[model samples]
Target: MSAGGAHLKDEGTRRQVVLAGGAAGLISRFCVAPLDVVKIRLQLQVHSLSDPPSHGSAAGPVYKGTWSTMRAIVRQEGITGLWKGNIPAEMMYVCYGAIQFTAYRSTTEALAQLDPHRLPPSAESFISGAVGGGMATGATYPLDLLRTRFAAQGTERIYRSLGGSILEIARHEGVPGFFRGCSAAITQIVPYMGLFFATYESLRPITTQWEQLPFGTSDAAAGVVASVLAKTGVFPLDLVRKRLQVQGPTRTRYVHRNIPEYRGVLDTIGTILRTQGPRGLYRGLTVSLFKAAPASAVTMWTYEHVLRLVQEMELAAEA
Candidate 1:
């Protein structure tokens, strides 16, 4: 989610970068929490998103589409259901943003020093993005798993509280449970981030030529396009990660659904293809794009503005 960081020529500016990164993440998460909840539910459902409820049909889906799923969640679990995993999600985003931006900046510097002439700018951006995104995803993966489990559950709650969920995973599934889908997550995130930063950087200059776009700046517009493209490219892996996160002894806790047990990433893909067809891999794609576009745009725009503000404050103090 990081586009990069402000120039870190000094320790003071470095600190500002971290602060701006965290603020950007919190703001973005708040804007897209509901969309995130819908996307997760759609991804985890075994039945197709369009399938309506039917007593006779075992394959009947509880969630029909983005709006329908939102309505169903409200009907079954109240309006707050849309923010079921907000706590961990916010925490994860904050940590992810800080780590991602710092890592991206550091990695980019390292790459520049390592082979500035050999590596192209796009390749550097791609590599740096991959490293940064991977670090953020790995560090915050437990929280991510918890967020998914929370969002995946319905009125029939599985693990009540965050601490309880942590203990439950530790006790039943052992430590590895926390990272059930980490492989798929990292696999998806690496390329996703690389593609995002590369695409955004490539498009930013061209988009800036417009100059009159009202919503934000060219950076934000580029971010929106980049995120949508990246999310679409690696969407199946994202679905696999969500499905894996909900697996374990509590798999059946989801209401009005029958979740199958998957041995691993490949098995999960196979099951989805066998049961729901190719579309299953992209079950929640529409909602995901809805989330990705605005989330990335907001993050990029906020990060740039906040970084400028923070750096200005730092300069004021020094002066």
Candidate 2:
């Protein structure tokens, strides 16, 4: 291929990769958000002691299955409740996924150029994924907090819109409230992203070689496999973060109608362990797994195909 042709091809590939990643992210979030709602409620219930009158259920909150939770949320809150913070959630996923994909591809390319023989190990992918997740989560955490609150509220009140909800949170809790779960979010998301990329990159080649699939096909397949593996590893942290975000001062009352209450992430984890045990930490794993598998598979597949199409279109335009 001519130099100019090669340049065009490279640009097309880059565009395709970006589009694919963004699409995957968007789809994954939408698909799994309902399960996400369930997870949040399960986490929050651990801390729901304070709002005794409002929240009810002192017997440590009944452990409903995912379907039951979904049914209850829908019956109590309506269709809108299931979606909760959908707008911001979608935006976060799109932006985060796009940046993540771009970063991963660029990093992989650079590393490959540096040491072609040395494939990216889990550690390297972990670091890269961690950086991407941290950056993305940090940028979008405020929105995440809002989504959690809205979902947790359970149709008791109405906000005029997303802006109204933000205003309410700001007025009630001040600026810091928006960042309530930030530390835990970063902790959870960073490793989740890192491990995801690392595992996917490391495994893609092996899986592809063993399966004898095309080169890029392995990368796409790897994305799905890696997502599941990483999610399983980091799900507990996610449970913690959601709990911290949604629990609020109300959670303290649940912990101890007195005793100064639990403060911050460590306190909450310790309390849950004392009261609830390991099962407390993994309330929604089943639903999460169900949602995650197809979500990841579809996301990665869509992203790859989208990129391919975009590249083809770009090349055709040039031709």
> Which candidate tops TM-score?
1
Scored by lDDT, model 2 comes in at 0.68
Model 2's TM-score against the true structure: 0.80
Compared with the true structure, what per-residue lDDT tens digits does model 1 show for residues 100-218? 98898788778756532546668877998999999999999999999998998887778899999899899999999999999999999999999998888788778879869875588
Per-candidate count of clashing residue pairs (backbone under 3 Å): 0, 7
Per-model C-alpha RMSD: 3.5, 5.6
TM-scores for candidates 1 onward, in order: 0.93, 0.80
Cα lDDT of model 2 by residue, 1-319, tens digit:
5332221113245667678778888988888788777766655665332323323445445335678678878887687667877787888788777877777666655544544354435555676667767877887788787777666665445445789877876787788878886888888888788877777666755766756666456655776688788888888777777776654544433221222244677887787788768777776777777777777766766776777788788779999
RMSD of model 2 against the true structure: 5.6
**Residue runs of model 2 more than 4 Å from their true location after superposition:** 1-16, 47-56, 60-63, 110-120, 158-160, 206-221, 247-262
Best by lDDT: 1
RMSD (CA, angstroms), candidate 1:
3.5
Least lDDT summed over 10 consecutive residues: which range in candidate 2? Answer: 2-11
